[model samples]
Target: MKRRTLMTSALALAVFAAVPALAVADTLDDIKARGTLRAAIDLGSPPFGMQDANMQPTGSEVESAKLLADHLGVKLEIVEVTSPNRIPFLLTNKADVVVASLSISEERKQVIDFADPHGVIQVIAAAPKDVDIKSVEDLKGKDVATTRGTTNDKEATTQAKDANIVRYDDDATLVTALVSGQNNIMISAPQIMNAVNERRTNDPLEVKFVLKVNPYAVGLRKGEDALKAAINDWVKTDLANGKLNAIYKKYNNVDLPAEMPKP
Candidate 1:
């Protein structure tokens, strides 16, 4: 009887797991009715997402998520995520939208849709200035640390084939590893690399080479047209009014691109 019950439960779970994709209208309506917008942000990525001195969530994407919820006339419910699980959270209905620093990639596009981009981030290879790393070719046999399951990971894995890729679970861990001298060479954002340099001042890291400049957007599950349209509209308005750019620049110390790329 126990085995039979377990089988029945498993069958029910499988059916339940398939419901999110089919509940397109419910995703948007539910948020409005619930009076809260579920916005997933990864606090592990500083400048993009992190905690303040008070331990309150304060960062670029965190503020952006707040703006989104406010624009929708709803309260914000932050759903913390990591580099690896942002999309999974959205697809599983754990998050109505993902405001993590998720770059728009053809690879990701195959799995989920994205709103219009509100910001851009440059992926770079950084290392202690003494280390000679001029390009991907220079990464041969070097230990390159990056957050696992991120775009930097994909770039390093595919492009820096000769390098020994060391992936941490998230950006915070990857940054900590760099500061403790666990890894010298790494593929990451300039902001993250700079954060590491601030700690290891005696042996500062520099941008060895730029890997890519990607426009990041809010991620949405496919078929959620209402949510996508709402997010896209908010991005356009905020970008035009300089609200989004202000929030981005406040945290990143750099202005957003002159024009946002479409997702």
Candidate 2:
């Protein structure tokens, strides 16, 4: 009876020790066995993730996802997502990773794990060149446009307290409102403002002032330490090789930030 009890206790200890290792192996093995890495991304946010004229996904985030897939020796599959849906997709196992321009935040950290930042984005106030806005204070009493439920909208609301904020469903509509004179100002990503300017033949829009600098990273399901470590390794290696900067330049027409955080 004594020998049996001792063997049972030893077996329990071994199982407990293996639990963490098994949890770490699950996601990596599933991804490899499936032979494809499904990357969730927003298909309408230009310069980070968007559908080009051909209606195929293209941009910095898409390229980054492709790089990750290549690194893993797997085929790449893109799953379109909105900002609010990005986390849900991961939680539901609909995507292996989210490569959208998801900003790192304390609230988000509660639900998912973020790899080392792949890039940085600045949220800014943009207006037509002739508009005399020089700062957030200048937006008082002016009509401002930004996508609903986004950091841009929140910042614009907080900083330009007296401004009339027009919330649109997506970046495309927000840009349209600015171009059509429905809004005199827009709070958005700098890359988004540049994308809008590239499409216009008239007076182009320009960033007035930056509201916030956000670090963007790949989102993984919670507790996937092995996958997170692998992604961080890839990001660090790419940063060292100049591959990440090349991808940023291809879509943003600028180099990656000089002070990007190291992995």
Q: Output the worst ten-in-a-row residue range by lDDT, candidate 1.
A: 18-27
- Using Cα atoms with residue i matched to residue i, what is each candidate's TM-score against the true structure? 0.91, 0.85
Candidate lDDT values, in order? 0.90, 0.84
Model 1 spans > 4 angstroms off: 1-22
The alpha-carbon RMSD values of the candidates against the true structure, listed in the order shown, are: 4.9, 4.5
Q: Pick the candidate with the highest TM-score.
A: 1
Output the lDDT of residue 263, model 1.
54
Error of 2 at 176 (Å): 2.5
Model 1 lDDT tens row, 82-165: 999999998888998999889999999998899899888888999987898898998988889999998999999999999999
Q: Candidate 2: deviation at residue 260, Å?
A: 1.2
Model 2 misplaced regions, further than 4 Å: 1-25
